[model samples]
Target: MFSLRLLLSLIMLVGIVLTVTFSSILSTRDAKHEVEELFDAQMVQTAKMLEQFYVDQLTEDQLAQLISQPILFHVDDSKIETFAEQANPNTLSYEHKLSFQLLSSTGQILAYSDSSGEQQLTTFNPGYDTRIIDRELWHVYSFFSEPHQVWIVTAQRDDVRQELVSLIISNTWRAPLIITPIMMFFMLVLTYYLFKPVKLLERHLDKRPAQDLSPINFTLPTELASTQKALNSYLLRISETMIRERRFSADAAHELKTPLAIIKLHSDGLSDVLSSQSPDVKQATLPYIEAIGEGVNRISHTVEQLLLLSRVDAIEALNKTDCKLQNIIENVINQLVHIIADYEWYIVVPKDMIINVDPFYIELVLKNIIENACKYSPTESLISIKVTQDDQQTMICVADQGCGMSDEEIALAKNRFYRVDENTSQGAGLGLSICQHIISLHHGELTFSRVQPHGLDVCIVLPRAQS
Candidate 1:
């Protein structure tokens, strides 16, 4: 996945590094130029000083001796420390690299530093120039002295300026190298803080319940203000739509009940009248009357379930009371006794175990679960209602022994109108969905599991009533 935070951090890091690198390159180039200029100025000063002081003081015979034989400056390695001690301790070791030559106006070498050797540094150029002498590059500055009638050529090895420039550039880069990581760390921290509001909004949405359509109440940045406004508006529209849907379902179901009851009453009366007629007429008409009654009963069941589901959907909060688990289970079983009579029921519930829930809704939830068990299980099969409690919650499980549901069916058992075997059952399939909604309103859970050795287990978990 592409992370916005990572992308932003990478962009910022790359931008900062590029900026630093560009600055360093410019700084190094300028420093190299300034170093070269400073050294060139020193060479000019040395050449002028040599002409003004030493060459001008030379006698005619002394000048003639300089032209006779070239001088060389050689030092023994053993005496290098003593030489350094005699001179200034801070004197650079590359001082010998700086050499000067005195030439007569005719371009003949009149005198030279011992290190300059017999060769001229350059072609007696009167200004700054670069030349190679003895395979070593040098920066030479040649000056003409009218009174001395000579050329003062001062040259320094190119390596001297290069090494000095390298030292300066290296030092300059050290600071940025050390500070880059610290700057990156601060940048990451800054990015995190800058995007904190976005994360807050994401977490708010993630943790919110599906039924919760309330507007967001967070202080967001101006950048996200429009997004927040749009989100709240959408939620408002959804809430209004859901309210309208629930009202319609409840109203429709209520309207259907009276008509269905009238149809059932007439069908039952017709069935009774047919029973008193001749055997052939009674047999022929009774089945049709019973069929009509059955159809009415199924419609009534569906309408009642729809009404219950709509009511459960509308309840956002519960008026919870401490209700005895045993009493709730007994009431549910009594209501379903006619159908459950064929099944062997095993009830294991503590008489005093209580749950904090709305009594009416909890009873309805139990009735749906227990009735489903009775309907699905075969005659004489085992059905168990077990109540268990822990410190924080109470659990009630209803298990039935019959043909068990597959994993796919169990997964969608709580969805409305999703029957495991729709062909075999005459249900609207809203029973578990209603139970789920009621349990959710109580801050409880409803779950379905496939029981081993063939059956279904429906468990309800509600918070334990405080003592």
Candidate 2:
């Protein structure tokens, strides 16, 4: 999964790092250039000072002695520490890297610093130049003194400028290196807060009940205001559509009940009138009248089931009360006694078992389940009603010795109007669907399974009531 927060943070972090890196590179380059120019200026100034103050004032005899032997500034290794201590303590170590040479017009070295050695720093070119002296690279500045007719050369080792440049670059990089991670952390925190409204919207939708189409009432950022309004608009449309559908189902079923009752009454009256006719006429007409009555009854049953289904579909909450499970089961059995009389019932329910449920709906669910068992099973076949409870939940199971449904049929049993054997059963197939909806309103589960030796087991699980 790709996260928006991660993507935003990475883009911002990379942008910041690249900006800092580019800035540091440019700054290091500029600082290096300035340091080189300053050092070069110092070299030119030193060469001019040496010509104006020292060499130009030299006596003829002194010049003759310099041409005979050059004056060397080299110090003995044993006296180096004493010399260093005696010098200025604040002087930089790289000061020794700077060297100067005074050459005669004929190219004989008249005077030189110890670090410069006997060789010339550069050729007689009277300007800035670079050369390798004693295998060390140096930046050389040479000047010709017109009065003295000698060359004044000052040179500094390249490593001195390189070391200072390296120090400036390293110090420049150190700040960004330490601050980058801290910046990234803060960016991530900012991104999380910025996206918090999206997470809140998701949690609100996920926790809502299926039938809940209420508009979201959260105070979100202005950027998401349009999204919230669009979502609320869609939910309002859906809620209105469902309301129309439920009302239609209830109204259609209610409108059908009166006509079906009248038809049944007329059929019953016709059967009585046929009884007074001749034996031949009665035999011919009785079967047709009976068929008409059966059809009306089936349609009436379907209408009632449709009304109940609509009621279950529209229910968003349950009116719950603590009811005795045994009493509920007894009531369902008594209502179904006419159909269950032919079947052998084996019931196992604890006397003190209590459940928190809407009594009217739970009773309807049990009646449908037990009535289904009696309808499917053969006469004298065993039908079992078992109630079991654990710490967290209560389970009620109804098992019957009947030709059970196949796996494919059981998978789709709860769908509205889905029947395993439509020709054999006189049902509208809304019973299980209504039961499922009611149980779901109570936050419960309904499951169907095949029993051994050919039967179906229907079970419902409900959460245990809190103390």
Candidate 3:
């Protein structure tokens, strides 16, 4: 009934997801930065250990000879391989990959601490800033001191920084799993308090009496203020329309009762006068008395038609039965037999055209159409009634060779209280409206078309009966 609950829940759910995801990203970055800094500090200690060997004051030739040994014994040089292994200290953290390099001031690799083999060394350049080094390498060099000509480089290839960041992300996401249910539980509790007024309003509505015209009495919630205002507006409109309809029905009853009482009093006087009068006197009084009688009869008929129309409006559906479509057409034609005597009646029908509808309702629809045709048709004009059926639908059409209506007239024909000739005094202006309503009850379509050469054709379609 209210869209608030749906809209609120969606917004809260999205907010929870973004909060959890962004927090994980920030925590992972902090943990990675700290671990990378610790690894780089260990690289500085390894560079200090290499500088002690150079301080023993070995000749430049001897230092170059030791540095120039084959990086590994893969070239059949055991001397170079042994010295390479001895230069590497038995450190605590080097089981993964122990590597070091001796570099000229120009940054050429003179020796490697890895006896495994020489790795491609083309990536480094002399006098470049250390910022270009990656987190995975953890490098340190001796560029800060004088005689920057010789440099000792040391690094460990643990990949522990990336692994630490991955671990932080994995652990941080577990918070979201814990957070989701907690948020849902919090949302559930908050929503109960949030929509308290709506629930009270629902209970109030459920317990209301069928004809209750009272305004809803929900306590105003600050969160749902607009909702309460809208409900009040709708309630006021319903009350006003109900009052109007009650007055209309009461007026109709009072207006009809007065004329019926007057007609009865007049009829009684006429009956007494006729009984006591002689034959000659009776003949003179008969015409005036009969005129009064005819007036009463017309009024009674009009009142009955008006009441019947009221009943049709109040009904939601009519009784339905599958009966002969042709029979309904014949009833209308038969009632107008005298009027059509001078004119030809063309009736068409298929062998099978049964439709589901109330017989009385069908008769009412047919009577109104035929009478309208009779009044407008010229002398000796033909009227046609045809009933046709197909697998998908059934159609009933009636047409008259009369002075046909214009397009604008046809459009207004089905509206309530409308007539093609506003000045012509005749039946009440509600027949076509009732006919359209009845057809709608049967789930049918009613169409009016101007026939060629001065005529009007009205067709009604009903869904065909299933085989």
The lDDT per prediction is 0.83, 0.89, 0.68
Clashing pairs in 1: 73-114
Which model, 1 or 3, shows the larger lDDT?
A: 1
lDDT of 1 at 179: 88
lDDT of 1 by residue, 1-467 (tens): 89787898889889878888899899999999999899999998888788778887888788778778644445322333222245544453456677888788888887666555768776765898988877889898989988868888888888888878877888878888898899888988988998999998999899787789999988988988999999999999999999999899999999999999889888878877877899999878877887888888899999988987887787767888888878887887788878888889898999787777788888999988888888788889999988888899888999999787888988888898988877878789899888888888787889888888889999998888898
Per residue, candidate 3 scores C-alpha lDDT tens digits across 274-366 of 879899888888787888876677666556556666667566557888887778777867887877687777888876578888889888988
| lDDT of model 2, residue 173 | 96
Rank ordering of all candidates by TM-score, starting from the highest: 1, 2, 3
lDDT of 2 at 57: 87
TM-score of each: 0.89, 0.82, 0.52
For model 2, how does the per-residue alpha-carbon lDDT over 1-467 read when each residue is reduced to its tens digit? 99989999999998998999999999998999999999999999999899889997898899999999889876433322222245544553445677999998788899998877888886998899998977888999999888888889999999888878888898899999999999999999999999999999999999887778989988899989999999999999999998998899899999999999999899989988989999999999988998998899899999999998888887767899999999999998888878888888899999978899999999999999988888888899999999998999999999999999898998899998998887877979899989988888888999999999899999989999775
Candidate 2 at residue 374, lDDT?
83
* Model 3 worst lDDT run, 10 consecutive residues: 75-84
Q: After superposition, how far is residue 252 of candidate 3 from its true place, in Å?
A: 1.7
